[model samples]
Target: MSWRQARTAHVTMTFDPEGLTPTQREGDACVACHKKWPRPRIRIGRLPDDTTLFACPECADALLPQQDDTHSLPWRVAFS
Candidate 1:
């Protein structure tokens, strides 16, 4: 499979209806969990318009979409 850049991992947070901030802040919780069992490297999967950093190797591997599983190798794309 060719590993092209892709974004994965949906941040789980509940929003406060009255405010702009999230009611449930899980960023720290997530990072802390990752830090406890840190991997050798944090893989970042880049998308056509953005970049995303995944905490686990498993997460990195799961970054690619099911539809594009065949083209998961390293390929270059000029995404600005």
Candidate 2:
């Protein structure tokens, strides 16, 4: 599949509300760091009830899988 197709096919994981705060649960805070200011704009995941979970750009990058880098070596590196 192509990069565009892969990206469009990407599926975000569901978040459990039990571990999240009220703000996070309400989508007012960043799901990863709880940063309230600037408002988390990236949709990282969703709650059990399908409520979208937001994250800052930095945190979203950390949470989501990295896109295949064309300049990188053919062999991909996986960081845990």
Candidate 3:
């Protein structure tokens, strides 16, 4: 029903001609909130695939798992 504030920034709804909008369809655009970050962050799932699921900025970042981190554990163990 309201937009979430992110990093002191406000997010408002601006309808797109592409028709890609938030999955929420009950109130004033956003279902719960919006976000602003010091770094680049976006909700990947909110691209209007028509799915109610979403990966928040944090979740999206985690999902993108650091390329180096994935191999760090294996290098430490030196498995044959």
Best by lDDT: 2
> Which lDDT tens digits does candidate 3 get at residues 11-66?
22233325433333312233224332333233233323343322345644454333
The C-alpha TM-scores of every prediction are 0.25, 0.72, 0.20
Q: Which residue segments of model 3 deviate by more than 4 Å?
A: 1-54, 69-80
lDDT of each: 0.33, 0.78, 0.33
- After superposition, the stretches of candidate 1 with alpha carbons farther than 4 Å from their true spots are 1-35, 46-52, 66-80
Candidate 3 overall Cα lDDT vs. reference?
Answer: 0.33
Superposing every Cα of model 2 onto the true structure, what RMSD results?
A: 7.8
| Candidate 1 per-residue lDDT over residues 1-80, each given as its tens digit | 33323333233222232321121122211121344244314433322233222335454445433445444444355332
Clashing pairs in 1: 2-72, 2-73, 3-72, 3-73, 3-74
On TM-score, the candidate that comes out on top is: 2
- TM-score of candidate 1 against the unseen true structure: 0.25
The lDDT, on a scale of 0 to 1, for candidate 1 is 0.33
Candidate 2 Cα misplacement greater than 4 A, ranges: 1-9, 69-80
